[model samples]
Target: MLALRDGQLYVLAPDGWTRLGGPAPASSTPLNREDAEDWCEREGWDLHLLDQVPQLTA
Candidate 1:
């Protein structure tokens, strides 16, 4: 699954979310990994991703 955490794009993986690069409508480079499970208890991963969907352009 795809998501955004702190303005960067992320893709879900076996271990955690890996940064796919962006703040979108911007640039892309240097992907990284951030442990996103912490968010599962807070606002929920689905909510987080939903909030950012409008920020993306087709």
Candidate 2:
């Protein structure tokens, strides 16, 4: 689960990774894993092609 540093709220998941959100670093790099189709559908994320990578852009 992901939590705000000030403890305002959080995201809970039975099985998934959580990130501390912020502007990504200056370096050009990928983040997060490529989830399965079923997993994306279950999570309400729309996977699309972004810069040749399958991106969960929801």
Candidate 3:
């Protein structure tokens, strides 16, 4: 899922945070939804915005 938090964007998975962008050099620079779409599409995936990201359990 795509989550915008603290003025930055992150990509998350069931395990935890993962790199964004597809098959490209991973970037720390945040990506907005539109750019995210292009990235995911390149990998044959779709970007979906989540209303909330569940807190990670420590």
Candidate 4:
């Protein structure tokens, strides 16, 4: 999962959440993983893995 908080973008890594880079522009919009990737690509921002968390088995 990914999140944008306080103008910065973070991704959920194996260890924990990690910041992708510097703060996003004020005009940036909230987006899901796929959309975020596309947005980053079009905007020339670095791409980060957008892996979905695996489901836990009981």
lDDT of each: 0.49, 0.38, 0.53, 0.61
Candidate 3 stretches with Cα past 4 Å from truth are 6-10, 14-27, 49-58
> Per-residue CA lDDT of candidate 1, range 1-58, in tens?
5666557676655555566764543443332234433444353554344333324444
Best by TM-score: 3
Residue 27 CA error for candidate 3 (Å)? 5.4
- Tens digits of per-residue lDDT, candidate 4, 1-58, equal 4566555577656565677776655775667777878865786655654443333345
Estimate the overall C-alpha local distance difference test score of candidate 3.
0.53
Native-to-model Cα distance after best TM-score fit, residue 11 in candidate 1, in Å: 0.5
Q: What residue runs in model 1 are displaced by over 4 Å at the alpha carbon?
A: 22-58
Cα error of candidate 4 at position 44, Å: 32
Per-residue lDDT tens digits for candidate 2, residues 1-58, read 2323243323334433344356434563433444444445676745332112322444
- lDDT: worst 10-residue window of model 3: 46-55
- Clashing pairs in model 4, backbone N/Cα/C closer than 3 A: none
State the TM-score for model 4: 0.36
lDDT of 3 by residue, 1-58 (tens): 4555553445666555554544333555666767767776776553442334444445
In angstroms, what RMSD does candidate 3 have relative to the true structure? 7.0
Choose 2 or 4, whichever is better by lDDT: 4
Off by over 4 Å in 4: 22-58
lDDT of 2 at 13: 45
* Candidate 2 lDDT for residue 29: 43
